[model samples]
Target: MDCREAREKLLLATSDDLPSAEASELRSHLTSCAACRGEEARLADVFGRLATMKRDRMPESVRAGYWEGLSARLREEGLVRSPGGARSVARPARGISARLAGATVAAAVLVGAFLVGWFAGLFTQQEKGTEPPRAVRPDTPPPAPRADEGREREPIESAPATGWTSDFALGNGPADRGEGVYAEFVLGPEAAGENPVEYGIDEALPQDPWVASIDF
Candidate 1:
């Protein structure tokens, strides 16, 4: 026999009303099925404990209306009366209350988890701490120009050779170096081989030979 049938038989056996043939079959099934045997042991344990509990006697006044009130309540709940007026079939609530209770517990758990995660994140950020603001140094002025820095760098000194003597000098005047500089060019009799010819500072020379002005 299956465990379902065997368990029903075990319940009936508690009242000593199980038939001899069914008892024999159940005993045989229990011998082969360890699960059913364990269920039978549990049932026996529960019944043994219940048997030892003190039984309270019902008063006659309460007992008289108890059955009538129970029957009326059962009828109001749409329960079907069974045989012998001692049994009934109640309409199950289909676990509606249990499902609602389970949903409430699930929502509570989700809220608790979210709170825990938020607190954890907050604590982690606090532990890492914020970086201090960097100290900003003030902008510094560049160093002053050196005394020898304003000398003119002449590029004409590295030019191709010309058969002329050129002398360029700056005067010790009120202006800065290269501001009041002067240049003197001594002309030559030949284009290439002749010696340079000198002219007096006060002489008015001819202007037709070569004249070019250069700005420093």
Candidate 2:
């Protein structure tokens, strides 16, 4: 008998319904097949636990529908052989348990793959963390200058000092203003000397239209 036939005969094996010849065949197949042996062991363990559970907890219609559907599948799959009778009776067992075990195995595989990927990511991050940073050399060239940096800046002359000087010294009152386009003069302290130089309006406003020209 194959594993499928042996598993179908499993419940019958526990009961008196299984014929001796079929039992011998099942036993021989179990020795060779690790999967069938595991399933047989699982059934025995599960069936014992199931015995105490209430079977009538579901509504009558629901229970009937479930059993009817399962019965059709078993008959269609030839998982259970019906004896010669007007009505099909005595189905082997629920194959749902075997399907559930397969589903469980698939779930475990997905979880195993997920955990492996997660740990691999962590290991990769740790490897990156352990690596030392590269050092910058002191002689490395600086970043290129900006386009505007090469242009010359406009020169700004410093404002004249507040204090007076010997040459071109500012008078006490805000330097006098004239009606014409007059010159305003101020000198720094560095220009102080005995020979005081006078700064006239013409020297400061030589190009002004109103500047008074002097003739020698």
Candidate 3:
């Protein structure tokens, strides 16, 4: 396999989860590829160091108290017995077990509460719409063309003009008959060809223009 493929498989190999055949193939590739082998070694070293780091240990006092509490609870619950036919008082060993169980349950409850609160906070923030600004990658592809592509460009036969006409003021002065204003107008056939129209001035329009009014 190539270096890229071999490097990807190296993780499975290090974890000893790679199938025998795949592992064998990767191993063979690694033997021949120094760069891939070096990368594998570096990853193995990092994981080994992480694994060797000491985990958080329960304090001796905390452990002792836990056991003591557990024993008392067990005795109260009638789970442990005393010697000499008399119901034995809660012992250290019993207390230790009980305390450990209690601590475990408490920890689980705390974790569950924390997770619930965190998710709730996240949802609340989402409802408020405080979203992190996305970094638009330069290489992202544009949206796909719509299914009705080129449909708008199809031509429609124009109807013959009717006799009805009306005059309207064009700005404050007489219209510049031959100035050649590149106006874009949408005329509905039912409006006697006097549809909503937009006139572009000599200057370019702003990026975000205000809408004054729209008539149906």
Top TM-score model: 1
Q: Every model's Cα RMSD, please?
A: 58.4, 50.9, 35.9
Backbone clashes in model 3: 8
**Model 1: what TM-score?**
0.29
Per-residue error at 132 for model 2, in Å? 49
lDDT of 2 by residue, 1-216 (tens): 754456556656654457899888888988987766755674454345333322212123222343344345445545334545432424323332233332221212221122222222323332343322212223312323433333221111232343322111101111122221111222222233322121111122211121112110
lDDT of 3 by residue, 84-184 (tens): 33433322233322333323222222221222222223233423545322223232123235433332121122223622111111111112321111111
Q: TM per model?
A: 0.29, 0.26, 0.26
What TM-score does model 2 achieve against the real structure? 0.26
lDDT of 1 at 212: 11
lDDT of each: 0.34, 0.34, 0.34
Clashes of each: 0, 0, 8
**Pairs of residues clashing in candidate 2:** none
